[model samples]
Target: MDIKKHKIINRYYHKNCISCKSWLPATEESFYSVKKNKDGLHSYCKACVLKKAKESMLKNYDKQLERMRERNLLPGMKKAKKKYNSSLKKKKTQQIWQEKNKLKLKNYRLQRDAHKKHNITDVQWQKCKDYFNNKCAYCGLKIEDHKILFKGTYIQ
Candidate 1:
């Protein structure tokens, strides 16, 4: 290989790491990038550079965490917060509407309870209704003919 193509290896040969004092091969892989340095290679070896970087990160861990917390409240992160707040507002509005419509809500609860007290779903209830041709299961009366009483309002 041409020595010019391997500038660091040719120039430094086998240099000792400043921090670890261990001999490392003079190559791009063994050194950190330093743009301003004459050979564009850091004085410290890659292992020392990484060790110092990790130590600095650990020392300022709390500051990093606080910065991340502040970042989460920034405009870029507002979409998820806005969605959560809007969903909560919608839930409150729905509750208020249900409270105002007592008769309608009562009918809704009766229909829900008709299938079973536990482990029942709207799909299963619809299946049951379809099986009986939308008629009362016990009385055999058409849903429009009979009024089933549950919570004051007669539910069809």
Candidate 2:
């Protein structure tokens, strides 16, 4: 393969590694390299170029973070977080109230029915009637006038 293709970017003079100073052929796949210049200085290998670029970038980022801290960005951020949490708490409370009220209404209806002293399950009623052949267990009462001295069994 032609090493020259790597020089598609303008090639400076001889290129070398930044850390070890070992010479390397100019190549495009390199992570960092000197942009071509009229001056005859050899281009740096990708590694040295990358180190310089990263150092500058990190320095700028640190400056930006310092500026933000000075401007009190932290307090504004906390207030926004607090407001979001409060809204979530309110929504949860409303949802819980709705669920509890629904269950309470169901139990109220069941209690009302139980208070009326209705004793027999539909199954029990049919069994009692059939076993007695339509005669009341106690008084031998027939259908339409069926009444027994004993109470219907309702476990609850």
Candidate 1 per-residue lDDT over residues 14-106, each given as its tens digit: 656778877677668888778986667777998788667656645665675467556564335577677766887777986788779999999
- Which residue runs of candidate 1 sit more than 4 Å off their true CA positions? 1-12, 72-156
Give the residue spans of candidate 2 off by over 4 A. Answer: 1-14, 31-42, 66-156
lDDT of 2: 0.53
lDDT of 1 at 81: 73
lDDT of 1: 0.65
Model 2 residue 152 CA deviation in Å = 70
Clashes of each: 0, 3
In Å, residue 134's CA in model 1 sits off its true spot by: 61
For residues 1-156, could you state the per-residue lDDT of candidate 2 as single tens digits?
Answer: 234322233455334554656655554554343346432233565556655655654446556445655654433457656676688777797467657799886888799988999677889977876888875454333444321111222111
Question: What is the Cα-based TM-score of model 2?
Answer: 0.25
